[model samples]
Target: MDKNLRIGIAVLALVGFGALIYSSNSKQARQIAASATQAPATQASAVGRAIVEVKVPEFEGKAVLGQLAYVAKCASCHGENAVGQVGVAPPLVHKIYEPSHHGDMAFVMAAKNGVRSHHWTFGNMPPVDGITDAEVGTIIAYVRTLQRANGIY
Candidate 1:
């Protein structure tokens, strides 16, 4: 194979192996994730939006718990990666969700009481059925992690 083709195959193989390992060691991994801290968001946007500049966690702690809870609770509307589906829901991986505007509590409350369609045309968001306040927090952490990874804070 050509050099670039060989390199692409290697990258894909590494990613696949990583996913396999991550899933196999999920429980142990979550413990380690607890020690991870949220990367601070500090990018300035001249267009009046906040760019997320936080580092992603290594799949441990609350973020992990949140990831589970999110898969169960929020992923349906928010999309698998919280990137919201077009004509379905708005992406959580966008700039409109700067910490200054959509505080952590907003996510918490939104899970508890649902939210109105203030930003998108996805209509109203009713409260989630089987998640708790604490789960919401962790889920927010997971969402933040995703947003940061996508450069949205």
Candidate 2:
């Protein structure tokens, strides 16, 4: 083939590849946006009711300790077993909190610095008071365990 023809083919191939990448990325972004807009069940009357049914598997080792810490520190708004609360808080066991999405450090930062509401309409999460970083780690372990069991991972 002529040199110019070869260059033209190469340019076309690159453009095609870039289009493919953009298409894939846009689809993923749309999916994430769709999920984020679909809020969980919320009730005006029930403030702390469980919004989703959570299947809690028996805990062991660090997860056991984590569960206790989560209950003491996070359950009031996040709900029992991290199922979430109606008109109060979002569920930690939800796909939104999966490690690939929210990660462990998100939990730590949210606890330390508070989080602005984006996913749920319940409102902003004020920085949790009187909870140490160590406790937050344990709480993440517990929530992650629950998330995995519930197929969020």
Candidate 3:
């Protein structure tokens, strides 16, 4: 095939892939918006809320310790078992938090330096005070466990 024709084919393929991605993302956004509208009236003012009911599995090893740490430091906002609190924060067990999406280092950075809001309407996250990097790792482990249990991973 001629080089120009080959280049045209590649460009067309890229455009098609981009369109597919855009379509998928738009569908997801619509679903999220629909869910938000279905949220309880009392939670209408919430910046972000639990998108899924998390199933808690038996904790083991570092996960157990991580759960404890998470409860102490994160549950207030993220909610018990990471189900998240209406009017407070978004669920860590949600698909958006899957390891492939956010990664463990994202958690560490969010805890240490805080994060600007991008995924949710909950506004920017303030740096978690007094939590060590090790503690954040444990928290990530805890959240990851919860996510997996909830079929987020």
Q: Pick the candidate with the highest TM-score.
A: 3
Candidate 1 lDDT tens digits, 57-109: 56667899888988888777766767555445656766667677798988878
Candidate 2 residue-wise lDDT at 149: 89
Tens digits of per-residue lDDT, candidate 2, 27-116, equal 776665444334445534565666688889988878898999988988988888987776668778887789998999999999999999
lDDT (CA) for every model shown?
Answer: 0.68, 0.82, 0.80
Off by over 4 Å in 3: 1-10, 23-27, 30-34, 37-50
Give the winner by lDDT.
2
Clashing pairs in 1: 33-60, 33-61, 34-61, 52-153
Please write out the lDDT profile of model 3 over residues 82-140, one tens digit for every residue. 87665567778877788898999999999899999776656688998999978888888
Task: List the lowest-lDDT window of 10 residues for candidate 1.
Answer: 43-52
TM-score of each: 0.60, 0.72, 0.79
Cα RMSD, each candidate: 18.1, 4.5, 3.2
Q: Give the Å shift of residue 13 in candidate 3.
A: 5.9
- Total clashing pairs for each candidate: 4, 0, 0
